[model samples]
Target chain A: MISAVSAPDPDVYLMLRVRDGDEDCFGVLLDKHRNSLVHFLYRMVQDQPVSEELAQEVFLRIYRSRASYEPTARFTTWMFRIATHLALNWLRDQKNARSEERLDEQWEVADRKPSVEQRMVYQARLQEIRDAIASLPDKQRAAVLMHKYQEMEYSQIALVLESSESAVKSLLFRAYETLRARLAHMVTGGTR
Target chain B: MNCPLLSEQTSDVLLDYSAGRLDAARATTLQKHVLVCDACSAFLAGQAEVWAALDTWKAPPVSISFNRRLWQKLRFRIWKSAVPVAAAALIIMIGFVYDHKSQKSQMEIDQVERTLDDIQLLRQFDVARAL
Candidate 1:
């Protein structure tokens, strides 16, 4: 089976190709990393459609910055560095545009619950987790996504965030602490 | 045993410990600290369970059309930016050819000057012969 051309280490080759006006390689890279990047952005933005659109923008940024690609760091680290910057900037712009943000209008998950009662319970618990995640400070939310979800080591995270490993750890600790406080009641009851 | 007020340091190390990154000696020290501190012990255990639950924190499935629409938008943007670059290259190529044509004309002009000078010399020789 001819699987999609796999991109392992030294994606510098792809970057170089992209520098030489090779948009195909960029497309391949985008397709390869889209799902994971989308998920990461989803965690950051807490909005599905917005995350998808934002992720495409991330790749476009990468494409434009092809001329400036240096192979000093792993491609993954470089990509997240850009992603985090974009997400943070997005948060800042949102805050500037609106004095205070509106609550997220969550789209319902279908067939995830068995009966009407189960559906209501599932939706409530889901909403609680969503709120807990949203209530976390932007940096902590980003740190949590990058560490817990992305499975990046602390050093890689430090590179992405331009912070020390200790700082990332502290951020994650605070984020986890916040989650514990907010969701402790719902953990067992799965209710409001 | 005197424990430092900075338990957060140990907590970070404990996270690394959970990830199996701590050296044997350091791990032993941290292991001892957790054993003595009930709060740290519970926190680590609680985080581990939360992490396990979070393993399922995946986003909902996106529509197939989502990828198509997103990539199309990206392509349109890139296409817009690329048009100018292509036009610039075309202009550069045209300029190079134009400069080459002018250089060839300048060489022909120099050759024509030498031909005219030779003809003048021949006419002077004919005039002298007539004298």
Candidate 2:
């Protein structure tokens, strides 16, 4: 039950309408969250096509489960919960799969940079960051992505990860600590 | 104001400060403490750099056909589900037609039998008349 003090979430209202057979509401929810959801999955899997497929699966699952959806938490929390599960499962399945990002794709995006030298440096640094993040333990990766990128509250992340808030915090700290060690060179003046 | 780095809970305070989630009052307190606490200040600076580096990795824009692809998949799933029901209905109709045809054939055989019996009775009556 929603506490009396908390204002009703607009997404939850939209979801409830979806529960009541409002197809338009589902579209609205999808339009609002599709990019973030896909981005989260993309970061998790480190593969765009796989992430896109997983995102579609996530929405498909949501659409499938609309009949039974309850306003138990924020719509995004629930959505990410499902997304995290799918991403984790995919990662587990592809445990031995290469974790490399397609550099050409990054180059395409990096083309917006002013000079070839600047683009090359940016690409190299971006690759390092991606590798550092991809090197984290799967759970830690999920936690950090949710905390850092999604800007999800620790409690919401816990709900998504099905762990306690403290555990989530610990996961994030460890993940960041690993990242800091790996990417310390990026810090200003090269030493933190 | 004990050093936030000394314990797990306090370390999280450091994280909150870096993330800007700390309240203004606590933020001021931490900021003042950081001026003298090299450990906390270094931790915050490192975290700041990490945050900045992370910000550079923007997510790729979502595909334009994402919704269309999803709707197509949904439509296919619906049709996939309907295929079995349609097959079942077809099977039931075939069974009913077969049963009805079998019943009609039985009635035709019964009519044929009655006609042969009538022929036999008349032949017997004609033989009786000849005797």
Candidate 3:
């Protein structure tokens, strides 16, 4: 059994308990961060099961490395540091293997209604945005996802991607540019 | 009304204007340029749609057993750490028990040797005849 203070949140206090050998503290941590982490990784890999698998691996690493965990950074920064590394490596390997051409696949539009034209339009729009994001070179996708989805400031993203803040900004700018170009239809139709 | 000024504002409009990362002064910086620039206005409009649509992309739901699986993994890792310590302790306990038994055996051997030495000495003294 876990205490109330430590059971509900993934705060630094709970993490401190985890560091001190409270195995259950990790369950609390997983509960708190699991949704967000899964979301972030899902945007990257576009596969639920793979993201879930990798998420588990990430937490396992956190637990295994708890002995050396320091308070030098926020627990999330350390956690995302590991997560971003795995994602970037996976992207790199996918590049080498020249993956299954996700740029043209409209996988994100699954499981929703398609009868009405508006719903179809919405679905198409979602697919366009997803495909545009997927078509971005790996770094740009990472930048875009890290910025917009993960809500990381430039400095935090820099830490995850191991780049400088200015560089991260520039990457986001480029990513935004690509997204804007590909999504020009949506933008143009916005005020029309 | 200058073309260059409008063109300069076009690039920055997409970065800060659309992402909502800009403050008042920076947003004001683009105001004059966007007033006359049709292309930039169109681009920003598109950004709004894309951003909104992207927000609807809910992640696939995590499995119901995700936490359980994570806990299982966590348990395994915890046990992995404890295993070495347990093994080392077991080894130490076994070594201690073996050393203790060897010590006991050595004491028994000493006692047996004393008895044998006494018996040999009596034989050398011919104690059987009670001379």
Q: TM-score of model 3 relative to the true fold?
A: 0.75
Best by TM-score: 2
For candidate 1, give the docking quality class from DockQ: incorrect
Candidate 3: residue A30 Cα off by (Å): 2.2
lDDT score, residue A123, model 1? Answer: 61
Ordered list by TM-score, greatest first:
2, 3, 1
What CAPRI grade goes to candidate 3?
A: acceptable
TM-score of 1: 0.70
**Stretches of candidate 2 above 4 Å error?**
A1-6, A104-113, A187-192, B111-131
Docking quality band of candidate 2, CAPRI definitions:
medium
Clashing residue pairs in candidate 1 (N, C-alpha, C atoms within 3 angstroms): none
Per-residue lDDT for A91 in model 1?
77
lDDT of 3 by residue, A62-118 (tens): 888887876655567677878877877877776644323232234344565344665
Candidate scoring better on lDDT of 2 and 3 = 2
Fnat by candidate, in order: 0.20, 0.51, 0.46
- The number of the candidate with the highest DockQ is 2
CA lDDT, candidate 2, residue B99: 100
User: What is residue A49's positional error in candidate 1, in angstroms?
Assistant: 1.1
Best by lDDT: 2
In Å, candidate 1's interface RMSD is 3.3
